[model samples]
Target: MLNFQNKNFYQSLLNLSLYLFVYYYFVRVVYVYYKLAKYISLDFYRVALFVPAVIFITLAAYHYFKNIQQLKNNIYLNSFLSLFAIIVLSIIYHFIFRLDYMSDDVFSYQIKNLSYSILNALLGFYLYQQLNSNSSKKIIFVVWFFYAIMLLINLNGFALDTKGVSGVHLMLGDTFIIISIVAIFMNINHKILKIISLSAVLILAYLINSRSSFFSFLVVYLFFLYKEIGLKNLLYLFVLMFFVAFALYYFDLLRINKRMFGVFQGHSDGSLNERMEQFKYGIEAIKNNWFFGEFAGQAIVHTQGYRSGQMGAYMHNWLSYYRQFGLVFFVIFTLMFVYAGLFILKEWYLKNTPIKNMLYYLFVFEAVSLLVFRAYSFTHVWLVMVMLYSYIHDKNIKNLSEKA
Candidate 1:
């Protein structure tokens, strides 16, 4: 069903590559950091990704140049101007105060992250030019399918143990939650397959033991499912689930975190408590250097002692941006996300299309995760942000043309 014309083919390839990177970039990070891939060096992974990205960019640039007039007013590219400006200023600030502000290694890592983000941003913009609801669905599903297969091959089964359940780590839970929710809500004809898939993912989420991901999955799933099946049906389903939960709890079959509910009382599991502590530290760093933000202080804290390397000891939320990239950067990124989210809500209200529903749910998940779970600089976050922006831009243009 994919359009394989010259430009479309290249753009689709770029799209596939970007999705692959987003879905498994965390896997790459884990593998490199843990030295798990004995046959594949970090440099090999870097080169593998970097080379393809460069080639994709080159081909995309050629197509854009060839169709300059048509592609000149790309909303996706323009939307990131403020973000790009902040990035430039941050880089200049770092260079000027390199000695006083940050170490060479930290700076290098940041630069590398920024470079890849920019490349991904470019690819996102290119894909947006040809993107539609159907294509978006295909790209996501295809990448998720392959990633699932990769996990199966590597683990030989689900990775559920005393350490926890994950395709690799907590990251896998996040990815699985998104795709699973989408799959559940999809209007596919095969009811048996859909039910089986949803059931499988629900079990997977439970086994993962990620309170954030499991509850998030339940929230979105139940909310949408209620709308689809109505309140009466939902109540019946809830009653059934309640009895199931009671049975599981009575028999000690439930494996969920015991402290999951303690978050309401400001006392939760260690990981939840640790995230709160990180937020406190992030706030202190921001306060210490309000204007430019205090990466050096955060870096020092992370380096002195942490589970994840210097860059990994973040608050896992938007505060990470506030602590590292300065208030201006935080404000710009926040506004962009907020505006895009509002646009999707509006579109869903007016049209109520399946694509719009998917977008809205995705926005909900990303918004919640970014506020309390996922880090600000996550590659998938950036991709989703741009996708929202492009969809908004496309809708606005279409409305304008219709009016004219």
Candidate 2:
């Protein structure tokens, strides 16, 4: 009999990398302890920032190569190719503009981190899709366990508590929490565990105070639960939501964080204004460089950031990428999303089952989340979507084989 429960080396590595990603998110907390050393702290970031990323990518690359015996096809090639094009263009623009300073900016400084994230996401989903039920369940559970550990640390006050990250970094880590909720709902046998798991996700989102993350989880979570358990049972859950919201407000937590919410309040906190300014700056930069936007000179982000102390100093999402990379990059990116969307739809329609149905909604929810968050900048969005589609596609192929 064929074994359906074997965990391969690559699968194990993928699971371990997921854990490391969670741990990397907490590195700033470790930095606080090291900050008191009063000695050289440069090596700390070098180790803390680069090591986890390097390990994850190295493992992921090996895993992808080792999985030749398995079935392939993760989303579409256009997505990956387009991202490659962007990276290339980003590189070319970096030099053509002759802006050496651009290489030292936050994104450039963390290019390896970005590359590692993208590579792991793409490769991880590819391997995860072909996993047998037992193996997939183990992988999901392992990933969820990491999230649970982080939550426990947060509850224990050991977490850095959002001080370590803001902007795009938080967006990257937040997706893991979203997937952890999904994993619990799917894998946990108990009903209460599922609900608590979801509630924990919302609480984490609230604690982070990311408007996009909170709203994305709220929409997807309530919608899914409403479908799963009906509205009558969700009243208590609604109460939970109310209390969480009330606590965040009553304790005046939003004041400390909160971005993109100043227009209606008759105030300018530099968050919302800065994003709008980014659009303005993008428009202005396009006219000067035309091909690569503002990769060079006084028009670049750090310059604008230094001048304005603004929030969104760079392209925020896929649409925003148009501002930096011109129309060609934007069209390629939009096409990639369309192609990925079609694949998910095809798989769901072919299967027409509950799990496949749920995946459809999940993909859509993730799409909305990435649009709100940073789509390409944060790789988890791509990772989660590709993982879901890979499973769906594999099932579709298996079904066709059985039918034939």
Candidate 3:
């Protein structure tokens, strides 16, 4: 007998399928970024992985919607739909009004952005529904473990090329480390596995010499540590870290790339310089079109060197939103996230748990990344935002039911 009504079975299936699809996005973006078409055509993965992922996701979603409660007054759903409407409207406005301003490459990037936005939103909602379960955390950790192992297997292949690029390291390392940190704190049974994953991710981050990623990881880890452990314990741990760092430095074993550490000494790398230039240009663009949006390729058109004439060469922050989507979209999205964050903090204050702490840590990570590191279009940021909002919404509903 097929137990079509079994929630546990469907939830497990959904978790496996959904994360596979999400991580496939990671791999796909890597392939595209590195131009690894000779290794495997993107179309090949689309047919082999994407098709089945979508179909399974659809089946799982059908079960979820059928079994779940009605969305008669779902504030989160309404908020998401409103934000998505703004996204669609902004895209249409750009396409219609800024047609002559955008080159072919710019148009292609916009199309990719639109498609990825929709896909990430759908994934976020599915994970939101799944995450309310007790086992979902374990399932997520297991999936991360699998991906971390795969990364270890292919570590050398993703090493810095002639370009001296560490974007892959920053992306993959930060992704795994944040999850591993949360999992380590939440799932005591999987402590060893989480430690192994975190170690691998740190190794990658160090070897690739991604300073921003290491800094981000340190900040979030310390924040969560302070929350879980008291300030006194954290200070003791800091003293221990200082000794460890001193020992490594004294042994001449801590050989971080000079360029990676140079930022602290006011010496900037080419990439840093480029980002500074983009920031300057982005600020100016914002000033010019403070109320409305600017053209898509205006950053490229205005810049003179170092990623000059590049399609997506813009600020790697929320400023990217203002430049592309205008002040209205930026304000609305920022407010949505800020409100979600505040709501989460309120809930956490009322009742803090390992799982809630993990969610807060994830929120802090994404918030930090978007402020200075990642571009506005980065899909994972949207996923994290939606996940946080979903958590808050679920908690709100639970509280209301309890009162009744």
Best candidate (score: lDDT): 3
lDDT of 1 by residue, 1-404 (tens): 22235855665665755554453444453453345556677687777677777776676566667666665676555558667777767777777877443567777777776776767566455444434556565655665566555544444233334223233446666766665544444444354565565566655665555666666666666656555567898899889989998898889876444545556666646777677777887887788888888643445444344423354557777688777778887887888889888888787667656557766777777787777676655655675676677677777778888999
lDDT of 2 by residue, 61-91 (tens): 6655555345244444345556666766675
lDDT of 1 at 97: 75
Q: Taking the candidates one at a time, how many backbone clashes does each contain?
A: 0, 0, 0
Span of 10 residues, lowest total lDDT, candidate 3 = 157-166
lDDT per model vs. reference:
0.63, 0.55, 0.64
RMSD of each: 4.8, 6.1, 4.7
Candidate topping TM-score = 3
Candidate 1: C-alpha RMSD to true structure equals 4.8
Query: Each model's TM-score, in the order given?
Result: 0.78, 0.68, 0.81
Off by over 4 Å in 3: 1-22, 25-39, 52-73, 132-139, 149-166, 178-186, 189-204, 295-301, 304-309, 349-351
Angstrom error at residue 190, model 2:
4.5
Positional deviation of residue 368's Cα in model 3 after best superposition, in angstroms: 0.8
